[model samples]
Target: MTWGKVREIRDGRCGKGRAGDGKESGGGRRGRGVETGQSLTLQSLTQWKVPDLGSGEGSQEGERVKSGGICAERAIAKHRAQRTPISSKNSSDCPRTPRHSLNMGIFRFRLMLLCLIGSLSHLNSSVADEAEDISHKDADEAEDISHKDVHCGVPVNISHGHYEYLSHHDDDTYLSVIKYACDGPVYHLEDPEEAVYICTEHNKWKNAKLKYKLPECHKVSCGVPKDIEHGHFEYVTTHGVTSYLSAIKYTCDANYHERDFSDEGVYVCTIEGKWRNTDLDFEIPTCEPVLCGRPVVHLETHQRVVGGQMVVNGASPWSMLLRGADGEIIDGALIAHQWMLTSAHALQGEGRSEAEIKANFHAYVGIEDAREMDSAHEVHIDKIFTHPKTKDAMVYSNDLALVKLKENITYSNHIMPICLPAHDLAAPGKVGHLAGWGMGVELKPATHLLYVELGMANASQCLHQLAQKQPGLFTEDAPDLFCTQRSALEENVCRGDRGAPFVVEEGGVEYAAGILSYDEACRAYTYAVYTNIYNHLDWLKEIMANH
Candidate 1:
C-alpha cells in the first residue's frame, strides 16, 4: 500500500501489457525511448510495476489502495510540474501507458511538484556556476591587462574570444576600452578578439579566421597637459639662488601671526604650483588684531597711509609732499638719523653723480615750508653700496642703499627715528608696509609719495622660480633678503618706488625692515627685497661706528 509499491505495480502492468501488444503486432517496443535514472537502473526497472487489482478483492482494500494511489499521484505531479523542456519538442509524443494513465491524474500532480523542486535546484546551480565562471574570467582578464607589453588600447584577450575597441575623438588619447558581457546566464568576458564565440558549456573561443576592422578614428588634439595647469608644486632641485623664484615662503601681514606651523611655519609653493601660507594653524587665515604702536612723534592727521601700520603728520606738507631729482614725491621712512629712507631706484643712476643729484635733491621731515628743505642736510655723496650680488640694471638686487645724514636727529615728538624692526621681524606672517614716492597703481610717473601695504612672502618661494631664471641669486653669499609681491594687484607699488623702506608696526611703533627692490614686468606684483638687519646687526653697528 506504500507509494513505492503502487508505482512498481503500475510500471509492471504497463510493461506486461506493452510486451503482449508488441508480440501480437511483431514484438516491438511501444513507449518512447526513456533514459533510466542511475538510481532506477534496468534491474530496478524490472521490479517497478503496477499490481493487478482483481475486481472484488481489490475493492475490499479500497482505503489502502486509495492512500497508495494518492501518494503516487503526488510524486508524479511533483515531477511533472518541475520538469523543464530541454528543447522545442512535442509533450504528447512521450505518452504514459494505460496503467500509468490509471494513475495519470495523481501522477500528474506529483510530476508537477517534482519538476518545480528540480527546476529550482537547477536554476540555483546554474546561477552559482555562472558567477564562479565570471569571477574566474575576470581574474584572468585582470592579469592580462596588467602585463607591461600591453600598450594603452588595442584588444588583449584574443584567446578567450571577447573582443572590442573604443575610440573617443574628443579625448586626448585613444586609450579608451569598451567592455562587454558574454551571452547566457553565465556572462563573463572570455577573451578580447576580433570575433568571439560562446558555447553552451560557458566556454568562449576567439575565431582565428576573423580579422578586426577598426572604425575610422578622428585625430585628437590635446590643448594642454593636465599636470602643468593642475599639478602640484614640483621641486626641481636647484643650486644657489634658484630657491628664491619658487616664492615658497609666506609671512603673515602685519598684525597677523603664524599659529599653525608653530615657529617652523614657512610658506611654500605647493605641488599644484599655487602659493599658500603653510604657517596658518586654521584652514582659513585671518589678520590678527594689530595695535599700532604710538609713534615717537604724533601726527596732526589721523588719516592712515597706504601701509596700514603707520600714521603721517597731517599738519606737515611732507605728508603728501613731492621731492627728489625726478620731482616725484614718495612717502619717506623716518629713519633715526634724520635721513628719509627712499627707494634707491628713485635716485637711479642719477644719484651716482652728486651734481645731478644734489642740485635737484631735497630732504624734508614733515617741514611746513614747501619750496626748500627745512634743514638742508648737505646731500653728501658718501659710499653708495648696493647688494654685492646685485647684477642686472633693469632688475636690481636687494635694491637698497643708505645715505648717511650729516647730523643726528633730535628725538622730538615731531622728528624722531622711525622704530627699527626688532630682530626676527620678518619671520613668516609678519605684515610689513612699504612707502615710496612711486607712481600710482598704474605705471604713470610718480606724482607724489605713495604708500602701500603688502604681506611678507617667503624667501624660498620667490627664489624658487627666480632661481631657475637666474641661477646663483639665492645663496648664503647673498643676504637673507626675502621678496613679497602685492597681495592685491591694485595695491602694488609701481614705478619710481625702488629703494623704498619696508616698515613693520611693532610694539605700537613703525620700524624700518627692508627696501623696495624691483618689479616683475609681466606680473602686477612688485618685488621688494629686504636686507635682514638682524642677520647683519654686527655689520650695521660696525658701519655706523665708522661714520
Candidate 2:
C-alpha cells in the first residue's frame, strides 16, 4: 500500500474498537478469521494479503485500494526483514490480519517521531551552552584590560634633596639620580659619588638598600679655630672640600715653633663631617714659644744689670712687645711658657681679613729694646682664643685674651714667665708696678722700656672718674675689671701701654694681677682700666689644658 493510504487506513481502524478484527464497518463486510486483542508480529505483518481487485467487489475504487494495500504489505515485509523478530512461547499464536499489520506500522512510525524530537531538543541545548561559554570568555578579556590600565605606565613620587628621577623603557625597570649634598664627593668605598639608583620589577625602591658611605650632609666642617692665629692649614685629601673621610694638617712658618703636644697636628674628617682628634681626648693642636732658660744674674750683689734709671734692663723679664707690620702695637705678659696675657682690643681689627691679621702681628720676646730685635726670639702666633662674648659685643667688657705661641718659651733670664695672682687681690691703696714701651710724660715714645708705680683705685672712685670722662662707655664697673691711678705725677702708663700687665710683689715674686686695657691720654692725674686676670684664671686653665 502507498504510504498515504496506509496512514489513512490506520487512522480509520484506530477509531474502531482496539480489537485485532479485520472487519469493515460499512457495507457489513465479513470479519477476517483473526481473534480480537491478539498480539501482532513481524511475520503476521508480512503475511497479510490484499484482496484481488479483478473479483469486481468494489470495481475501480476497489482496484485502487487493493493496489495501495499491496504496496503497504511489501513495505512492511521489507521493514520486517531488517528488524529483529520478537521471540514468544508460541510463534504461531500471532495473527495474520491486515488490521494488526496496520497497527504495527503506525507504532513504528510514532517511535521514529519521538526519537527525532529528542535529537532536535538536544542540538538546541548544545548551541545555547556554546553561546554562554563565549560570553564568559569575553568578560575575562575585558577584566584583563582593566587591570593593565590601573597598574602600568604610572609615575612614581620621589622628593629627597639632591635626588632626581630617571625612567627606563621597560615598565618593570627604573632608575634615579642622586646629587651631592654636604657629605659627599667621594662615597661608597672611594667611589665617585654617583647619585644613580636602580629599581627592578621585584626590587622596588621601598626594598632598596641605601648605603650612606659618606658622612651625613649636615654636620661637617673644620672652621677656623680661634687658637690657631699665626699658622696656616690645608686639606691633605681634597682641597676646598671638608667632607667626610678627608684629612687636614697644620704647619708653622719660618722661625715659628709648634708646642710639643701629644697631638700629631693632623685632623681627620669624621662621619659627622667635623675635624676630630684621633685620640678623642683632645681637641685641635696648639703651638707655643721655644724655651731659652733662665737669664744671667749678677753674682756679687745678686742683681741684674741696670739701665734707664727706673726702667732698668731685665727688671721685668716677663714683659713682651707685641709688634705688627708697622711697629709695636701693644704690650703683653708671658704668663706661661706657651701662653701670653693680652687685651682683647690688642687683637681687634673688626673689618680686617684673616690674611691681613696674620701678616700684621708677631710676638717679640726677651727684648731689652724694641728696636733691637737681633737678640730677641720671634715667635709666630698660633691660635688666638678670643672670648666669644667679647667678639659678639665688639667691645672691651671682657677684654682678656690668651695668645698661644708657636713654641714653648724656654725659661731664660730675660724671657721668664710671670706668675698669675691666686685671687682678685686688687686692694685699694695697694701699689702695683706697670711697665711698657709707651709714651712718657712728654707724650713721646720712650727710648727704653718705661716703668711706673700706680695705686689700686676703689670701684666707687674709679666708676665716678670713668663716668665723668666718657659717659655711657663705662656705665658700671664690671667684676672682671679694676682701675689704677698713678701715685705720683709723671708715673703713668700711656696709650701705647695697652695689654701690659700690672704686677704686684708677693713673697718677693712678682705676680700678674691685671691686664692694661685702656687709659686716658697721659694727664697730671691719670687713671687706667685693667682686666682683672684673677677672675679669668679658671677659663685660662681650661683653655690651656684642652688646646
For candidate 2, lDDT tens digit of each residue in 1-547?
Answer: 4656434333333224522255564354332333443323333344544333334434454444444544556645655887754333223233334555555655675565456435545755787899999998999888655544332223243322243335543343333232333224333222224343444332343222344232223334545432474556777887876766677776544323344332345777775446776653236544454332222221121112221123443567778887777775678888777888887766664654445656788777877675665435788778777765575324547787788888777653356777878767788888777778777666777667767777898866886777777775565757777888765444567777888898887665677888887755367446788888888888889999999
lDDT of 1 by residue, 494-534 (tens): 55555556667665566667655554321443444555555
Best by lDDT: 2
TM-score of model 2 relative to the true fold? 0.43
RMSD of each: 24.2, 26.6
Kindly give the stretch of ten consecutive residues in candidate 1 with the minimal lDDT sum.
Answer: 222-231
TM-score of candidate 1 against the unseen true structure = 0.37
The total number of steric clashes, by the backbone 3 Å criterion, in model 2 comes to: 32
lDDT of 2: 0.60
